[model samples]
Every structure is written in structure tokens, then in C-alpha cells.
Target: MSSPGPRSSVSPSGRSWRDRRLDRDGSLGLRLTLAAVAAFLVLVPFALLAVLVVGSWTPLHELDAAVTAALHRFAADHPGWVRVMKAWTHVFSPGPLRVAALAVVVWVWRRGSRRLALWVVTTMAVGGALGALLKLLVGRDRPELLDPVARAAGFSFPSGHALNATLAAGVLLLVFLPFARGRPGGRLLLWTVAVLLVGVTGLSRVALGVHWASDVLGGWLLGGAVVAATAAAFRTWREQAGLPAGRTTVDGVAPELVDPHA
Candidate 1:
């Protein structure tokens, strides 16, 4: 009798590892849900592109109307708002923003998966290149603005800096989600900081006269699509490779060593 000796009291060394595949009953539903969302994100961009293509015939005339309205309003009142808008240009300044982003990534690298770091670099680099190619094809001219703060050399239909910012922010989020395991509060804080930095960079481009509002918007759409596609690819790769999805790393130290999500 002896109270059955606390059946299987010891947990297995790899007990934290969980299977990522859906169970039989849930598989169909999960697959369908993912497919629907994937199709939506993919198709939305093409629809937006269609609008831009049709609008190109009168882009300059449209731009003139918009800029004139804005200037007339600014001339009447709210000079401070104009200055504030101009100040936003600082966000797109290449040097300081780049350093700040890199600092966040380095700070997050406690147990540091080199693969994750590589993915971040690849996402940004490929997104930037593709954006540049598209800009060349569109060959859109920059907006005409008086006393612009900085000069941008690239064709201006879609801002490359804005595109890169969105991709870098989004890919980092996906790469970090699987690794996050500590108090929910800390995870939320980190994500908020990352998002704000990306948003500010994109906004800065418009304020500085380096890109139009539409250019920044297009960059966000294109960059976000690339990021989502990359994340989906990574999910498939991890599944095929049979790596642990949400488990703390066991190859080096015990789960308790690095505070789970740090």
C-alpha cells in the first residue's frame, strides 16, 4: 500500500518542451484560420498598389493641391505647430536612430541565439534592397518644400528608411515572441519601446521633406508584408527542424539560470 510513493515525482530534464503541431481534432480549424489571415495580408497590399498605379497620371497635380491647402492653413495660424512638425524630422536622422536600435537588440541578447540575430540583419537588408528596386521602378519625385532639413538621394515613391524601420521592428517582434517567458509586464514594456522607435523613424521622413506622407504609408505596407512573410517562413523552418518552440534553452544551462524570459 504505502501511499503509492508519489507517482513519477521527478520531472524529465526536457519536460518544458512542448509539441507545436496541432492535435488531430484541432488541426483542420487551425490550418484554415492561418490560411485565411495569410491571404488577407497578401491581397491587401496588391489592392493598394492598384490605386497608386491609377493615380500616377495626376500625382503632381494632386500633390500641388494638397501642399497649397496645407500652406494656406499654416500661414493663417498655428506657427508653433509648424515648428513642432519640423522638429519631428530629427527622428529620421540616420546615425542616432541606428545606434539606438542596435543598442536595444544587444541589450536583449542575454543567451543570444546567433540565428535570431542573423534573421534580423537579413530581414532589414533584403527589405531595404527590394524597396530600393521598387523606388527606382516607380521613379517618383520628391515633394517640393521650402527650407527642407535634409536631402534624400533615392526616388521618392516609397521611403526606404521607413520601409526598413517597419521591417526591423516587426521581425524583431516575431523573433522575440517565442523567447519571451518572464513577467508579462516586462515583455509588454520591451515591445512598446521597439514599436515607438520604428514609428518615429517613419514619421521623421515625412517631417524632414525626405518623403511624402504617402511614401511613408507605402513603406509601412511593403515592409510589414515582408516581415510577416519572413515570420511565417521561420515558423515553418523551426517546425521542420524539430526545434523547441516556446521552451527555455536547455542546451547550455538549467531553465532557472537566466530568468526564463530575460
Candidate 2:
């Protein structure tokens, strides 16, 4: 008797994710459980990254050394280029992030998406606290380059600039994805831009000779974890508000629990 190779896969139970969603019912308990699992899955890589980079890992150390050396070499001939990277680096600096977040908060609040505005601020606040905790735990030092083009203070296990940039980019993506519904091209373009921004921001640290390659990697991973958690939280809020699962536009946002504008 011939057996069926496999049953046809069901459409993602809900929407989004690997283009296929898991079969999760609409229940607060289920959402919380799912959120926790998703957060843990995202955070595991960050934890592993910290362990690998903080320890005496030869391969990571070698790669870090090679990248730092190459960037240092490039800086020697292209001083102007290094200066550009240094300037670009400020886009993700603490001051810019704070300013951007404030603007976003105000914009979203005016648009009647107070929940989203709150999430935006919370993500940054949580990132700063988590970053400090990770740095204290890892206790790693900044890169000692032959010729550093920039100076930094504090432990350098994870690049704060990279982390904050990633969070900000992720927030923008999440906020705008609803606008991109039914337009795969726009979604793809946004994803590409987000990736490039995150990559360049992380690389800026190494290029300017302030952070090791491994530190940037750790920041990316950690930032990814935080983004995942925040996205899940926002999704839950949307679902509870009776918004559409797959497509939700700014015009569709329900009044938040605490409406400052009201």
C-alpha cells in the first residue's frame, strides 16, 4: 500500500511569520505563552553570543582582529571616508535615538496610536537598561586598535549604538508594515533598508575602531531579541483591540486605553 508522503501543510494558522503562522487560538493565556516562547527563542542566540565573545574564543577573536586590522588599514588611506562613517555613526547615537523616539511618540499619539507610541518609548528605555545589565555581566573592554578614529567610554561587550539603531529601525518597520499590506515589493524594500541600516550601524563601530566585530555581533543579536519581544507585545495589543490580523492601517487604530488626546 502506498502511504501519503505528507499531508498538505495548512496555511499559517493566523498570519505573518516565515510567511506562515502557527495555529494559536485567540486567548490571552495562549498569547502570553506564545510571546514568552518566542522571546526565549530570540534571546537564546544573544546569550550564546555573549558567552562566545566574552570568553577566550579563538575564532571570534581572530575574526575580530582581522576585521579591525583591515578597517584600520582602510582608514589610513581614506581619512575622509572614516570621517563620513564617524558622522553617520551619530545617527544611532543616544541623543539622536532619544530625539527620534520623542518625535515618533508625538506623531503616533496624534495619529491615535498611543499604544504604539508607548511601545516605542518602552523599547528604548528597556534597551538602555538591558544594555547596561549585559555590559556589566559581560565586563568586556573596548577594542585596542593601532589607530582608533573614535573614543568611547564604558564596557564594550555589546555596541549600544548598534542595539539602539536596530530597535529604532524595527519600530519603524513594525509601524509601517501595515501600510505595506498587499504590496510585497514595498515590504521587501523596507526590509532591505532596515537590514542595510542595521548592518552599517553595526559596522560603523568596527570601522571607527571603537568596538570589536564580536561586540557588534552581540548587539545585533540582543537587539533582535528585544525587537521580537516588542513586536509580539504590540501584536497582542492589536489583536485585543479587534484589529485585523494580517492588515491594519493607521486609520484602523482603535483608541488606546489611555488616550492623551481625548
Model 1 scores a C-alpha lDDT of 0.58
Estimate the overall C-alpha local distance difference test score of candidate 2: 0.76
Candidate 2 lDDT over residue span 1-262, tens digit each: 9987876665545445533334355445466567779899999988888878777689988988899999988987898988889888986686787687789789888887767788888887888779889889888888886567788899998889888888877776766665555678887877788788889989889889889988888888888888778767776767776764453223122323223344
Question: How close is every model to the real structure, measured as TM-score?
Answer: 0.63, 0.81
RMSD of 2: 8.8
Candidate 1 lDDT, 47-128, residue by residue in tens? 4763674377467447744754465355336556556555654544434444644654565455555455555666666777
C-alpha lDDT (0 to 100) for residue 171 of candidate 2: 72
Name the runs in model 2 displaced over 4 angstroms.
Answer: 1-26, 247-262
By TM-score, the best candidate is 2
Give the 10-residue window scoring lowest on summed lDDT in candidate 1: 248-257
Stretches > 4 Å off in candidate 1: 1-40, 50-112, 146-150, 177-182, 246-262
